[model samples]
Target: MTHQESLYGKTPDQLAALCGELGMPRFAARQIARWLYVRHTEDPLRMTDIAAAHRQRLAEWFSPALSAPERVTESADGTKKYLFRTLEGHYVESAYIPDGERATLCVSSQAGCRMGCRFCATGRQGLQQSLTAAEILNQAVSLPERDKLTNLVFMGMGEPLDNTDEVLRALEIITAEWGFGWSPTRITLSTAGVVPELRRFLDATKVHLAVSLHNPFHEERMEIMPVERAWPIAEVAAILREYDFTHQRRVSFEYIVMSGLNDSPRHIRELTRLLNGIKCRINLIRFHRIPDSPYFSPGDEAMVRFRDALTARGIQTTIRASRGEDIQAACGLLSTRLKGGI
Candidate 1:
């Protein structure tokens, strides 16, 4: 018996090719897409339009994939953390946040992260293989509450910009008419400002962009994010300057506030200076402490003061409402935990 084709990885174009190879009609691709994405129909035989013989043949060759939540923990505030076991036997975590009317699922791009951010839990593990487009999208597509999804972010575990090819291909599959068909506006990809990968992403997609700039000063930033030692935030900002984010797309900075460490009026001034000429919002996130991290969460008062300081300097800044804290599933907390940590 032949091995099955990975149904999760097939793009519409790939699906069309699959249908052609199976000796099926061209229109069969449309039916298959409708069944897969629109109707959420997983059973091949349920596709009554396809001939019975072809249905069996297709079913034998393809199977809809799902990373069933091997472990699910729900927080008091309705945030859910799911540990999904990939087919490769790696466990990656994804979070589903239910905000009053809309639900957002934060997906992972790689099995583990390579970028060594002092604050992130995922960074403890060295680089694992990049997730395939299927693995990346399945975080949303295979979720039990997938139909209720209103937004998706490549912000769960891995640094999305590092896996540029897989990330972009997955976005294409997500927004394609034959796939999830979501507007690019519904998705956001975050990075620790990897300059070259970031340039390619900005040119190729209209999805919202978020740069992880925890500290504005180069010296202090380098202490936390090692990438800063190579591609400085100044260079990242220069590349961003070339893009027009005025109306079509959004651009934002993710500044995780560490108490007395990187949260102060002085830090705010430096942040404002760094973003001097740009029209972008700064989201001040509360620091989530990891083991041996030595960072403390910034108090609300300090966060508010910092936000106002940046705003007074003509920079749009907002202190982000911290979520998923009760579940140990907030910012900088996601990791595959595949081998129970290093």
Candidate 2:
């Protein structure tokens, strides 16, 4: 016999209809939604308030789609990287960093990636599949410290813009008052500036944004990130210019400083010129070494000089601290491997 679908992807109202179809009392749907979303109960069988027969029907027909990491590797610096399996058995990675009072979870939106930013580990893996809404939610819901999380970032595995529909749906579930109910302020979505969808996200949500802009010159950026070929950085900035980011919301640039590459004074001057009108901060990231990658992290002196140059020009800038370097959980370090099946 075919089993009834679980209520995972269903909204509170959709789940209500599911309860009626299962021959369950109507009120049971709201209770179940509360149990799954608010109470976070893992076992439907253990919901004792419901009548035993009704509970059995609910349990047998619908199964929860929660997840746990198949394997976890941690760095001594309090950084933990996880490999999670999707419903279809495809693997994805998320990272948790317990830094002081704030704990951040780097969530992935796709199984692999299609953006093909040459410096990114996920891009190297290639796009295997786009994650379902359930798969996307599972990353946050199944985190070991779900309640303690202070921030969530879509910076781990995929080009969120390519999977725009699912990413936005997942964001709605995250920010919707009836779902996780998280304030949009607590979430930040980074993109390589997928031109069209960037505006859609801005129009729909107030979540913060970070754009990957390693080099100001179109040709230079295109050399590292293949996405530059299609959506030029100039066009990305033009769209962003249409929006006001002076207050409330934030916009930042992610510039991975590679030694000897795009870190010279010439590049810096061009970068300053490129970002002159844009009211955004620049975050200098230390590029993590990966096989066959031509980039190398800049030395400490160079990093300091780079930050100072930006500061002198009245641009706010800071070098992002390197975390989980030992365990490969730092920026551009998450890659899924075949292991024990989930």
Candidate 3:
């Protein structure tokens, strides 16, 4: 049996090529795009604009490639975590966080992560599989509050730059005119500094970037995040210096504050020195404790002191509010382990 492809993630150009192969009119591609993206309908039969025979032909070889979440857990704060099962029989998660006037959905790029950050739950599961553009977009498209979403972040389960191609494809579909047509400013892709793909991502899109910079010293960062050994934080900072983030496109570093581990004055001084030239903000995240993890969140005063110290050094900084902790949907807490297949 031949495998069927889903039309959900294909770009207008890609769909046009498919139309040529199928001998359908070129205009049908845009119609299909409107159906899948604007109308949020994946069923070809409901695409009345397309001829009945052409719709039948599409159905024969293609599936909508959309699936509703298998399970959803809501937090006391109203944040919801959606569990999605991939076509590959693996599970991934997406978090929907609604602030006063802004709603952000944290979507996953891969089922599990291979970066092996000691403090992250997703890293402990090891790499299961990289999600396709379809699977990645499904998190936002199939969302219950899809229309209300104000921003999207690739910060859920995996390192986005680790799966650059599919992530970029999803980014393209997200911001393209024939697709979701969202402003690049409304999207942010977080990475653990996969250097090569970082360069590619910078060149390809105008979306905001968030780098995981939990530690300042190279040796110390290596102790917690093994990616430091491959792509040092120093080198990542240097690469970032080559780009321009002073305008609409912005870059920010994600720092998870641990009690006695990384929130010391020495770390703060080094962080100031490391980020000297780059015009970026530092987001201080409270570390969410995982089972048997030695790391712990610092006191509120300590976190504020760390943020103020960084702010005093000229880099703008703020403490990121922790959300969905009870549901394990906060930063560094997302994992599919209890949902079964590792």
Evaluated with lDDT, which candidate comes out highest? 3
Best by TM-score: 3
Off by over 4 Å in 3: none
Write model 3 residue lDDT over 4-109, tens digit each, in one string.
Answer: 6888998888889989888899889999999998998888888999999999988887876889999999999999999999998999999999999999999999
Candidate models: Cα lDDT each: 0.83, 0.83, 0.93
lDDT of 2 by residue, 244-334 (tens): 8898788999999989888888987887888778899999999899888888998899999999998888889999999888987888877
Lowest-sum lDDT 10-residue window in model 2: 1-10
What are the clashing pairs of model 1? none
Candidate 2 local lDDT, residue 288: 93
Task: Report the candidate with higher TM-score, 1 versus 3.
Answer: 3
Pairs of residues at least 3 apart in sequence or in different chains that clash in candidate 2: none
**Descending-lDDT candidate ranking:** 3, 2, 1
Model 2 stretches with alpha carbons more than 4 Å out? 1-5, 16-30, 42-61, 337-342
lDDT (Cα, tens digit) per residue for candidate 1, span 98-193: 998899998888877888899899888767678888778777777888889999988888888888888888988788888778999999999998
Tell me how candidate 1 scores on lDDT.
Answer: 0.83
